[model samples]
Target: MFNELLKERLLDAHLEFFRKDKKKFLIHRILYAVIVAMLYAMVIMVIKMPIWLIGFPAAFFIGWKFAYLKLLSTKKNIDIKNSFLFPQFLQSFIALLPSSGNVYQTLKATLNYTPDPLDKELIKLIQKIENGNDRNAYLAFADYIGSSEAYMVMNMIYQFSEQGVEKESIQELERYIQNLQENKVDELIQHKMNASDKFGLFPILISLFLVIGFAGVIFMHYMTNVTDALNTMPK
Candidate 1:
């Protein structure tokens, strides 16, 4: 089902952060829901409301938290995949291509110097090659990245490996890398603007909430005074 697929993806997204202990992860999630529900139940009891009302907000809050964590993990993965490392990776690949004897050697040389998740991916690609899955390895690397630009780069490399590198092909690959770098710069600027907007909005929201709280307190004091005055008057 669609929901099952979504849940699988969400779990996979957090795999690095949470590790592979499903039982531990489930226990933590359950504790989160239980603690949230208990807090909401306490608030409802204080307000002299029916206990059933607590269940709604508790369930809603748990769903919201799950969605928030899922989104956070997804953004983290995107940041890792689209890191400045990619530009460095492309540059290194291009540089190595000229001196390395073949695509595998070029990739192996690049792997020695590459970082983190990209290095992890290259390891998988190398394993696939060792297992005689060269064709699938290229496609798998593209899928692992989930990037159109990555797919293009991988495909280009595969073509070069098959038909031998051509001047025109290398030139085209360079142009793609240049465009990718430009896109990354634009994305970075947009991220900064978004962060600035969030920072700016937070203070305004906090101030508005504080003003409303103060007004509520003053209104309550005024109403209490009026009631006391009326009780002592001609009534």
Candidate 2:
């Protein structure tokens, strides 16, 4: 029950995270690990002689595909959600240009334009614009991407672009975002280094323990056999 709850919590967190950051690739790694574990269990259950012999490699290939499918599903969801915000950011950023193109005109141009993944999010903003909704609030995509630096930048941009707030406020926001992103990268690198160090120690320790334990058991069995043979040989 505890494990089920924990798994549910983790799935919820991943779903929530994928909803925000469409470009991240960690979801694939998780799915691959899950499928590998499933395949291992499946192999242990096969009863047929030939099938059991082949199950290991067969399960590995099937599990690889299963993992790929899982990763694709997660990516599709992320793409859909991220697509909802593309137009607004594109319009706002383009509007910063010296051209006289109005927001609607810019959106019309973009609708006909081929959208890259990042820019496709603008289509949702265009839909909101056409529906007479608040486009300013739609400009909050930058912060919605799950990065603190991105959120701060979007917040400042949202205030400026949506609420007709001061433009100069964005300068400080930019500086802050730069610093935050740098710090975040440093922290991530340090965390990976620590994880690698811990992982490196595991195989060596496990191998050493297994070797010593197996050798001791074998030595004891050999000694017992020698004593039995000697006792039985004379009288």
Candidate 3:
């Protein structure tokens, strides 16, 4: 019961870090840590090691895993913000612009279907535009996301707002933005493939090590028994 509550609290804290829903990821991380700690404790108990020996390493492992999970989650969030979602956003914005005829109307129409983090940022930008703070809105958005794709999108919007919408230029920019997004997606896919390969090898390596270790222990035991039987034989 106590562990369950602690896990819930940790997940809640993690959820607070992102504008989007990360509860599922947080729960998975917390559960992973707990299971790992429990296995560590079980190993120590089986080895007849002092219970106190489990505390420090278990705590450290939990903390390390949590930090790792946080790092991965943050990277995934950045990827989604800059690469995955932004391209779709740009496409939508570009498509809506020719019809909506203005940055504000385009953003407002896009917001109706946009998801969180992006949606929230768009809301802020819309508010800033409404209050006649276009400069600050652009700056705030660029700084908040700190994504190159976001910067490009914002620049495109700024240009459209100033120079009037040109369909050809907008289409060209959209295609370029989409290409960048595709490249990013490719890089991410390659990274995941590499990681999968590494993970695949890891289990095999661990199994080999365990087998060798257990075999050594059995061999040593067998030799000891043989030596004792020889010594006890009639001579």
Candidate 4:
């Protein structure tokens, strides 16, 4: 079950760059996780902290989270690549629609022009079309893109071919897609800024909490000592 989940994550992340070394990748991640847990356990032991009380689980959780961070970073990179290429790919498809006059033909013509990741998916889509699925293949391709804007663009392309929409409308959609790409870029930047701020704030929050906790402990100890002294002296 865990292996299946990992496989699904790899696929979702579109880490085709790691296709050849998937087993090695899995092995390395597992080893890294184990090493992290072991090092943490040793740290706890050196500090004389009891492992039976939450130490081991915390170490494992830390290790798992750190390993998963690698996956998250890889997915972010792939997503960025796709976002950068998608607008251009859409324009290429739109350009060919007049010549090809059908969605499948337009995509086949666009395949050579398409870049990596998108090209790979295009190849699959073409195969699905050849397999007799027709419109279903096209609709599924939209969903497979895993982007809402991409889905809309693809569906619009299909509608254009089916309904024979005006060239000006196609050109307008092209402009809209270009603007969409620009907006997506701005949104990505904003999200990154928000993430940076959160990450920046997290350490400060942790530090403040730690300081308060230590101060509370010291204050309690001091108050207890004072109370004992007062009790002995007067009463």
The numbered model that scores best in lDDT is 1
In TM-score terms, which candidate is top?
Answer: 1
* Segments in model 3 whose C-alpha atoms lie over 4 Å from true places: 1-72, 75-82, 230-235
Tens-digit lDDT track for model 4 on 79-189? Answer: 777877888788787788788867778889999899888788789888986776466666666655668887777777667656776878788898888798798788889
Return whichever of 2 and 4 wins on lDDT: 4
Sorted on lDDT, best first, the list reads 1, 4, 3, 2
lDDT of 1 by residue, 151-190 (tens): 8888888888788888898889888888888888888799
Per-residue alpha-carbon lDDT of model 3 for 121-192, expressed as tens digits? 779889888888466677677666667767766877877776888878887887887786688789779989
Native-to-model Cα distance after best TM-score fit, residue 23 in candidate 3, in Å: 22
Clashing pairs in 3: none
For each candidate, the alpha-carbon lDDT, in order, equals 0.76, 0.54, 0.73, 0.74
Model 4 spans with C-alpha error above 4 angstroms: 1-32, 44-54, 161-165, 188-235
Q: Local error of candidate 4 at 65, Å?
A: 3.8
RMSD of 3: 7.2
For model 1, the run of ten residues with the poorest summed lDDT: 1-10
Error of 2 at 38 (Å): 11
TM-score of each: 0.79, 0.47, 0.65, 0.60
Q: By summed lDDT, which 10 consecutive residues of candidate 3 come out lowest?
A: 1-10
Query: lDDT per residue, candidate 2, 1-235, as tens digits?
Result: 2343324334445456556352343456456656875667655666435445455655555554554356446665554444333333433444442242344454446555434555554566666667764635454445345444445555554444445434355455445545654665676688789989999999999999999999999999999999999999975
